[model samples]
Target chain A: MENPPVTDFATDWDHTDPAWVHDPYPIWDDLRQRCPVAHTDRYGGAWFPATHAGVSAVAQDTEHFTSRTVVLGNGRPLEDAPPAPIGVAPPITSDPPFHTIARRLILPAFAPGPVRALEPRVRELCRRLLDDLGDATEFDAATQYAQFIPPGVIVRMLGFPEADEDMFRDFIHVVLEGVNHPVEERIEEFAPIEAYITAQIEDHRAHPRDDLTSYLLGVEVGGQPLAPEHVFGTIILVLIAGIDTTWSAIGSALWHLASHPDDLARLREDPDLMPIAIEEFLRFYAPVTMARLVKRDVEFLGCPMREDDWVLLGFPAANRDPAVFPDADRFVIDRLENRHLAFGLGIHRCAGSNLARMEMRVALEEFLARYPHVELTDPEAVTWSQGQVRGPRRLPVRVASA
Target chain B: MKVTIDAARCQGHGRCFNLAPDVFGFDELGNGVVLVASPPDDRAERLARLAQVNCPEHAIDIEE
Candidate 1:
């Protein structure tokens, strides 16, 4: 869906706008300076908090905002969707009280210990991907390398077919990037995803395996099997949330390195710098800006918000807030005092953060090790994905050696 | 100095454990726990302070 170019983002902001999609940092920076909280009548009336304080306040405030529908669309979410506290995606879409219960059930799976156990597998996947490029001098890094890493790992985790990776990418695009489509169109677009998830759940039931999908089906809360919706929601959440977000992170970090040779050289010189560089990459190119539906009409950050209003929680923007970080706009490779809200803040913080970080670190380490002398073939040719998750969709780079 | 993590504020970000492995470790749920409640030396103290400052949730507290 092509949104009309945004003239004055303060009053009429559209995240899907071409200008914002290509590069939103400037738009967010402009909004931060002019109006800390920008309101727009689009998306059935929504508010955008540009400043770190405003974003942090709304992210931490459950009373005023509802997580029922984190993804904003033209249609009112509650019209046909489930009520607050238990939305389509549990934990992420579930509000507090209930949010904790749902979160705890799956937290252990993504806990540092469990996530660390997958490092070797993730590193192997990265190596395989790099090896596949095999003596290629020029290749698309985003699609060829970065994009394949997360789907490979997630498919293995979910016990899904390796062939379904392409389909997963399509489903993510429909759910995330196709926000501006009409409600009817949106429902039609979502039909395949719904059908696919249902079929996967049924299959998992028939053939139990040591995978996350089976675990979710078997796990109980309060000594009772999880509700069908709970199991389904959590499975869908893991698949959708885990894939594109990390893929984007890996892609963006590579894109940055391809563009900035000095940073790449420094990373090559200091192997220990990978961990710090990864954090800096997350802070600078942080993808994934979540949305929240206002519970009731209330004045927040001095803005008069109405019931069911969409709050485009911009964590990516918050990461770039100058008041929060010194030289916020500049990417510091060895940034020490960094507390960027890339995974977000509060209870709804990303559950797959550990896995995401591990994938990113391994992806970069392997990529640079394989193709140390890499640069953009055509910087202008690179394309960034639109909507909440941002990253290079097509990165054309020339590698000097294998 | 005494180091601690406010369990209420710590959402298991793992920053403490990642930054200062000696002073902090993660629980089963991955939330940070003070391994050495009182930093034994200046090195541990520096690491604890580093974790405190880098914690996005501000969950770490050091009483000097």
Candidate 2:
């Protein structure tokens, strides 16, 4: 274990800060111009790669930056020590050859086939959720509509009891928001979630079903059954990975729609433009920004990063990079030649990208048809989470029931 | 237009299939599988280009 290199970092930034979460672009814009490879001693000293090229390189270079502790400033024992170290999972924390197997097991669920198969269900869910909002002209889109779809889809996929959704949501919040808690407290909070998942795994063992847990139980890696620890971790990963990530994305997109009626109407008029629009929304309001712990000493984009140091890949910043994307700040729904990194690049790209897109598309289309005149009740009041996933925590949209 | 996919580089983000379903298909493992269904018209040609450009891996190529 080598000591982290101490150096005076140029910028002082913290993701846990609400101001940063509400609007990080201005600060990121400043970083890209002044300090593309900036550093901070806040979280035991971590680097911030603000530029597109810099973040892309950091995310792709698996040899140097490892996905051990993705959460920034994830130190352990409720103290200043770096949090639990390549986490015992196969895909997210595991690198290269090992990641391939774990990713493959979950790939089919998100592939075009399964996603397409779930389309009708998605539409129905959207309609029912909208129905639940009947005669209500004023509502928070975040809770009323956007937040429900992702977790609902996951529950159906995992065969978890729908009644347990509130509990699951609570667990996910604690786990994902654990950055604010001490490592021990975080673990204590997460113990029930782990126990619940364990019971599900054991139940599936006794009565195997077609759900993800049952399937994962039988999955073999390199002809040997994947370890129980890894399976449990993967399930937890799926819960956290699936729920808020997509909801944040969908919330942001709807927020954009509320603010920009022209774009919303255009999408309604030309539904064919949706595929392109979805991509554009993802690029502009990209939700996830994950970090990787440096595995060994390596210099990235001329900045020397040492082992165990955190380097946050600001993927959303990369999408706004003018060098790669012309008119990067503006949201062009039908923008051609748009290759955005809303989902992180390389092997660790979002495992649920397809499902996310499908959910967003269904929600957007159905809402447009039912409530065509959706607009933000108070644009200034919209707030986003200041964490790995970004989305409107409270989005009040005014819609005239038609 | 003829298109090619560099199998080695493809991490299977599946944008190709999502954008241009006619041009690309998915293998069992969810990697994009180039289809024999060629771009037969201008609309398809446009989609093929969109798919190629949006590929996160830059795995697709056009040979018109």
Candidate 3:
């Protein structure tokens, strides 16, 4: 399902384009200067908002845009997908009053208090992953280190077996990366994923544990347990949303550090800068670009969006818009006046933000503590993942001590 | 200076509490809460201001 190479992104934007996948910052910058809102006939007419203002308006104006499907694909939800308000994934895919209820049910699990409690465990996980690297002078940091952290954390939270991590990664690839697949092919791809999730639910039910899966099963909504679809949907969200998003964040941050020796040295030199540096990394290399289907025919940001049109909400691009932060393009380690929308904005802010932050901080701390020096083994060889979540898929770095 | 958080706008990004822990805190749901309504000193006020501007939702407000 290869999309033809985009001739002009301003008019015909395709996120899956090789040019966009290689480096989107420049494309976004050009679009911002030319047309803040870029329209594409691809995916049955999609709009990409390139500016902070345009993105913010669309994100907050839930009345006009629906979160029926955050990931853009050939198949429109209005055609064959689940009814709106409660889409395939709860909260992330749900809209309005239903969105609130769905979000609140899982918010406590990722609240700051509980998330902070997992810091020690996250640190230990990072340490174990780093230890696996042994004394290798050169290694693929993205595959070897960053990729493992989120899946490891998620499996523990979901009470799934650690050995099933490979399966979980495969499911994520099918969902996030397979956006261009035809509708029927997409359904076939999800068959195994659906089967896997069904089995896990049964396992959690038979042997209820104190983990999130069991908790989701036990937690009542209103007066009764959540609908089976709700339970299944939320677990799917936890797996898809929680895994690669943070993994990309970590991998991209490490990628930045590997390439920028000065930034890396400064971070390693000033241990206090890790938190602030993490924010800059998130802003500069924000991995996620959520899609929103237009609720109805409407005029938005001077663009006539038809019903079911996909609005590719570019939080990553918004973070780079000069209208928001001073020197928005520059990565400022000690940036204090940063109001970056890496986790997004409004009512639909990322639920697992606190957890993601803790994981990234711990991952970087452990990696840096183990190897004081890290540099890109070959910058040209670095490849970024396509479709929505962007980050280095193959980040080869030299960790040799000088 | 006095500070307040618009609970409606505060979706609990936690920038307020993260930047100025002494002046701000979070509720059980992790939404920002103004711990120190009126800053005790200049330094506290600066930290409060920092939190205000850093808020992604612009939920934090400062009265000078």
The CAPRI-style docking tier of model 2 reads medium
Structure candidate 2, residue pairs in collision: A75-A83, A78-A182, A78-A183
Deviation from native of the Cα of residue A90 in model 1, angstroms: 0.5
TM-score per candidate, chains pooled: 0.98, 0.93, 0.98
Q: In terms of DockQ, which candidate is stronger, 2 or 3?
A: 3
Error of 1 at A308 (Å): 0.6
Q: In model 2 chain A, where is the ten-residue run with the lowest total lDDT?
A: A77-86
Off by over 4 Å in 2: A1-10, A76-89
Global local distance difference test of model 1:
0.89
Best by lDDT: 3
Q: Stretches of candidate 1 above 4 Å error?
A: none
Checking candidate 1 for backbone clashes, the offending pairs are none
- Model 3 Cα lDDT, one tens digit per residue, A1-402: 679989999999999999999989899999999998998999888999999999999999999998888999896844556655577889998998999999989988998999988899999999998888887889999999999999999999999998999898888999899999998888898999899889999999999999999999999977899888889999999999999899999999999888888888899889998878888888989989898989899988998889988999999999999988789888888887888899999888999998999999999998899988999989999999999999899999999555
Write model 2 residue lDDT over A162-204, tens digit each, in one string: 8787787778777666576655677788778878888988898
Ranking by lDDT: 3, 1, 2
